[model samples]
Target: RTVYVNGAYLPETEATISIFDRGFLMADAVYEVTSVLDGKLIDFEGHAVRLQRSLDELEMAAPCTQEELLEIHRKLVELNDIDEGLVYLQVTRGSDGDRDFVFPSADTKPSLVLFTQNKPGLADNPAAKKGAKIISIEDIRWGRRDIKTVQLLYPSMGKMMAKKAGCDDAWMVEDGYVTEGTSNNAYFVKDGVIVTRPLSNDILHGITRKAVLRMAAEAQLKIEERLFTIEEAQAADEAFTTSASAFVMPVVEIDGVALGDGTPGPIASRLREIYLDESR
Candidate 1:
């Protein structure tokens, strides 16, 4: 695979970053992932907008313009021949020759890097058909989740916890309500109404979440942007998650409790279909 590093495109093995970089040393970085289907980038503009928002929230400067970023994505997709995959972009505060707890000088430039992952048939992932089972874990992440930083240790640990428990992923709970899945925005349905937590610093404000909610509303599906507890989700008619990678994935069970008949429900299936169709 080919990768981008400091304005240079190179083979994956050749790309490198400084060991003292702030992003590596202090987790001072923001990132975005844009999926590609049929060789066309999906929701590039949305990701671009969110990327800027994350940077702005961190008091960081853009390494390049949005248009330039789009062009780089296009170039990498072409170079890698990626038809169904994702473009991952990251920007971090550049480093000085010496490491310090204090912020670097304002003259320091930010480092920009991007790469493509070829996931062949990513949209048609079979896991979406069989559905997923999720276990709930405590939300111990830092509070600034609204910023898409590269600090994913907690989420990665949650995924491991789910795997050890024989589930697909983990829903993070905080203050008596389900915050979100380890890597995606969580949702559930009851009486044909889709319910999810309202946007806040507690969650990442997923780009895919915004698009799916809009499409659901356009199809006249009722939505309730309020918090729901894990017990409530266990009794929900159905459950699912949305992310750049998994678009809309049905959740058949929660903490060993089966939702409905322990299968993907019609509402989740239909929304996934509509999302794929409209997004393409």
Candidate 2:
């Protein structure tokens, strides 16, 4: 495999970043991932926009133009011969002699890297067919959850907790309201109405979530962007999570309790079909 590091493409075995890079030392970096299907990048523009937003929020320098980034990504896909996979990109505050609370000198350039790899088809998992289970965890992340930063220890721990509980995913809850899954946007359907948390610093505004909303509107389904509690989710007729990779997948159970009939609901399936069609 080859990795795009700074201005050159290098073999993965040879690719390297400075040990003092803030992304590695202080986790001071932002990243984005976009899925590619049949050799074409899906929702590339949306991912680019979000990447820019994350950089701006962190007051970091833009390493390259969006067009340049797109070109790099295309070349990466070709170099890696990636067909059904994801493109990963990251920008970090450049290495410094030592860690400090203040930002690095303005003359220092941010490190930029990009790579691509295949993700197993979780959407087609037989467990997903029946719908998957999830467990709730406290949202113990920094307030800037909207930025796609590399500080993912909290979510990582949450996933471990979910696994120990025999759940497929973990939902982050704050003050009695469910925010989102560790790596996906959470949504639920109640009385035929689709509900999800509004875009805010409390959660990442997912591209797939936006696509699902658009699909729901086109399907003439009632959609609401509001906070729903764990109790409310457990009482929902259907539940699901969305991401660039997962697209749309139902949550059949939460906290070991079944939702509705413990089956993938029709609305979730229809939205998934619409999402996959439009994403192509």
Residue 144 of model 2 has an lDDT of 84
Error of 2 at 159 (Å): 0.5
Candidate 2 clash figure, as a count: 0
Off by over 4 Å in 2: 120-127
TM-score of every candidate relative to the true structure: 0.99, 0.97
Write model 1 residue lDDT over 183-220, tens digit each, in one string: 89999999999999999999999989999999999999
Candidate 2 least-lDDT 10 residues: 119-128
lDDT of 2 at 149: 96
* Best by the TM-score measure: 1
- What C-alpha lDDT values do all the predictions have? 0.94, 0.89
- TM-score between candidate 2 and the true structure: 0.97
